[model samples]
Target: MYKKLFLSCIFSLLAICPILANGELDSCESEVKRLCQNQTESIKKTLACLKKNHKSLSIQCRKEIERGVKQEVQTKPPTGMLFSGGGGLGGRFSFIPLIKYQGENFGPLGSDDEDKKTRLRRQSVEGSTPIGKIGGGFISTSVRYGVTRFKEDQFLNNGTKVNDKLEQLELGINFNRPLENKKNINIRAQYGYRGDRIGGSDYNYSLMTGYSHPTESGRGRWQYFLMFSNNGPLGSNIPIPGVMYFYRTSTMNLLLGLPVLSFQWTPENTLFSLSLSTFGPFYNLEVNYGLVDQVQYFIFSRWKQENFFLSERRFEEDRLNLYEKVSGVGMRSALMKSSVGLELRAGYSSDRKLYLGDGLFNNDRGSLDLSDTLFLKLMLTKAFR
Candidate 1:
């Protein structure tokens, strides 16, 4: 993954310097001198005059000017005005409206032994800034909380079900420092806790860190990045890479790179998206759509192949192979007022692949089979733009 991220970063960096690429600025050097003949006062004034004569600028000069103008416009928002949670990659930070909140409830998907219930709920709030630039470096950080509940067969002596609920606290950050003209370094890290309601699994935690280059491509309209995080089976915290290409047109956005491929059409109040089997799109459209679309009538179904783990140590024991698949279809609708939206969804899932793994119930290499199921979801999100 790290290797792929590094390669993609290199390619995306190549994608950013359109001015230097075809010598756009070089081709327009003579134009700048000709247009601002009497103005040797300052580079800023000269550029301003050039912009005023924008209509008559040559193609290359216009392209270069447009790129700079686009970036300049964004800078007007003040340093910490904006941040992204990574396309479904959970992120935070913003300047204009730096606070955001989201909450979602996942319907019960199946039953455990003795037929109780398994359910989940999640909520998170994130804040960060693009305005925190200090000595050419800036950082964006975010935190989140989530919980899950399952029917754990039986209860403990205190009447509290042991290991019946899973809770997590998450933290993440993205930092950058300029390297040279039009290039900068990108670094990110995340820590998560996935424990039970009453101190269930002490081994339930994941930590990852990544490094890459921060780049803006697609004619200066979007940011593209290549990143590699160290959390694979082997806990080596070394840099490896993976990439996802980003291109934002007036109507649609496309992202494609090894292990990552997806696209979304965002013309207005409506959005249509498709996610591939690669790393880029997996939960993006599926999960995000379920989370974002609240105003329209929508239907969705997915077949997910998943691995079940009792603890992180089970990974080393090769016991992580407990295979499971949940195929479900759902319909959703949304109600909105300004920046706040509420989404509701209901569906049915086929849990036929629940127990397709390798081991028995003691260690549960494979899990138990679940018949058919019905579920619902309610989500509320507030956008601060």
Candidate 2:
């Protein structure tokens, strides 16, 4: 009975083997057809089922599907709308716009005398070019139009009230080139023309040369600048004090000096600048009268983060071995984010010989000079980039 039972079991197993093998072959063929149709959902479901039941089939199918998907993604093209290029003559262009209005009053601290009062009002528009590399060096141009009206009750301390109004316009060209020494040094130059309207019309020309050095560690930078300027008068009634005595016009004057020792510090966001300037005496159309030597020094410090700055200025005039000095200090602060600011300045002046025409007052005792001035200013600026 045991031998008969064993034979029946072997015959049943042999019949089931062919059926199981045919079932697996049909499933694999269906999976291949679905894959060719790019039906990733059906492929994934089939792969999961195969992995649970057969390890070898799962590995082969997953690898093939992954490779196909990767190739498809790699060859696909991007899809988006197209746009026109910007209209720029010299490549990409950007603009910065600036507008400012200022008002100031200068006089003694507690004096209400209009005779010792002066008021100035100015308005201007300024713009600069975007930074770019071109033409062997960087190039840019700037232009501005400004109107200044000044009223001095006591013009020359002689009690001669003078009301002067001036309208000015200027245009400048700037160029820069890197030095060959590799010391991170650059040389720059600028040429400009200025037109002024003082009672009549006048024109002037100016040129400036400078060197700039950037810090190696990127902490600070410095620049040194020298400038020369020439002025030509239009009307014959204009006053050229040192050049033509009292009121002589059509004189040509030359001024030469260095105007900058600018330093920028990064970690502190502070800028310290010193300007030393001298003006050579005026020369007539034919010859020079007497050389009027003048020296001016300006020191300014600005803290960007705090939006505050302090400036001090000293001006000295020497002629025929006699000298006079004027000194002042100014401070500025930003009051709001909307380009509003406040300014306060104080000035002092001294004349050695008490020149009658100098900007000072005198009494019977001696020369009445301003020990200091407490003045205030307010301004509004619109800045854009």
Candidate 3:
């Protein structure tokens, strides 16, 4: 169990760059200078211009640009995993509105009191920015904050009412730079600090340092990386080592290794695709169909877990953890010239468990099994280059 938790922590530590096959953008330099003379300030703008005029471009330019776009879509990280990347071309911000969870009573297990219905609400916001460039790479800073609130309708068997609210905040910075002379070899580093409860002793720091090597293959590229980081959960204080490999083609991208396995595929010029990823104790599966270049519908299922340090002790333990399995369908669309995005999701949350103890496997303090419920979420996002 400790090994499993350690791998989950390693997932956050590994710094993998989804560098598409090189030469695609460089090969179109002349075309950009000719067709997009006014939008040469940034790669994002140049790519947009190329896409807008795809039908009129030279055959080679059009083909390469199309391949680049498909690879970008296939490897782009999900909003929730924004801070996981070592570096990014542009930055993004995401916010999830406050949502409630309700269905049955939420008290201690094997308790006869059915009147202790609890009101639970949750919300979160996160963003990242590139501060500067170093060795032809970008250095990025990221922040994430979230809050969960709980209120009980009546007093439980114990004298105190159940109010195990939690707040989590994390700040991070990361960078990826190539070796002095060998551009094929890259060095990556990241540092993060998480404060489980503001002004409490539940804070921890994480550090990761690694290097990656990319080799050219037929119609694709292969990247391999190795890293070392601090452990994932409490009571473990050793640095762990991990390794991962990534392969990308014009239509498919795959990352295979311990603690992380991701696969994404899209047919050339098609509207449907599928993505599946698992890291540590977390996993997400998605099937998407596009209506237009900027809008899509999807079905997804995922497992999410959160751990915290409580300010006040309800039992003998000072730690609390929650895990939930969710399945849902949603729609997302890019608007405002593809700089803004909105998503609406409705789903069922089941197999929810909340426990307290020193760690995940050692939950001897108390545990609660929550009843299944339906949930809805509205997320808003903005991108800046």
Q: What tens digits encode model 3's per-residue C-alpha lDDT throughout 1-385?
A: 1111111111110101012222323444455567778875655555466446534555444333333333333332322222234222121111111111112222323334441344356676766555666666545566666666665422223332235556656665555454432234333333333323577654534554555454554333344444332324322234445566666565565676654667766666766777777756567787878632356788999876665554455643345566778888988664534345566777877787666666444556666666566677776655442
For candidate 3, report its TM-score: 0.68
In terms of lDDT, model 2 sits at 0.27
> Model 2 — TM-score against the truth?
0.36
- How would you encode candidate 2's per-residue C-alpha lDDT over 1-385 as one tens digit per residue? 1111111111100110001111212333445444433432342333233323332333323222222211212111110000000001110011212334455444444456543443334455544443544655455444545554444322334332223443444554445444442222222222232222222323334444545443454222344544333321111112222211111011111122221111111111212222221222211111111110111122221110000000110111100011224345554443222323333434443332222211212122222233233334444444332
Model 3 Cα displacement at 80 (Å)? Answer: 12
- Which 10-residue window in model 2 sums to the lowest lDDT? 304-313
Which residue pairs in candidate 3 collide? none
Please list the C-alpha lDDT of all candidates, in the order they appear.
0.36, 0.27, 0.48
Query: Among these predicted structures, which one has the highest lDDT?
Result: 3
Report the C-alpha lDDT of model 1 over 101-148, residue by residue, as the tens digit: 455444443455333343434455544434455566555565555554
**Local lDDT at 227 for model 3:** 38
Number of the predicted model whose TM-score against the real structure is largest: 3
- Give the winner by lDDT: 2 or 3: 3
Native-to-model Cα distance after best TM-score fit, residue 229 in candidate 1, in Å: 5.3
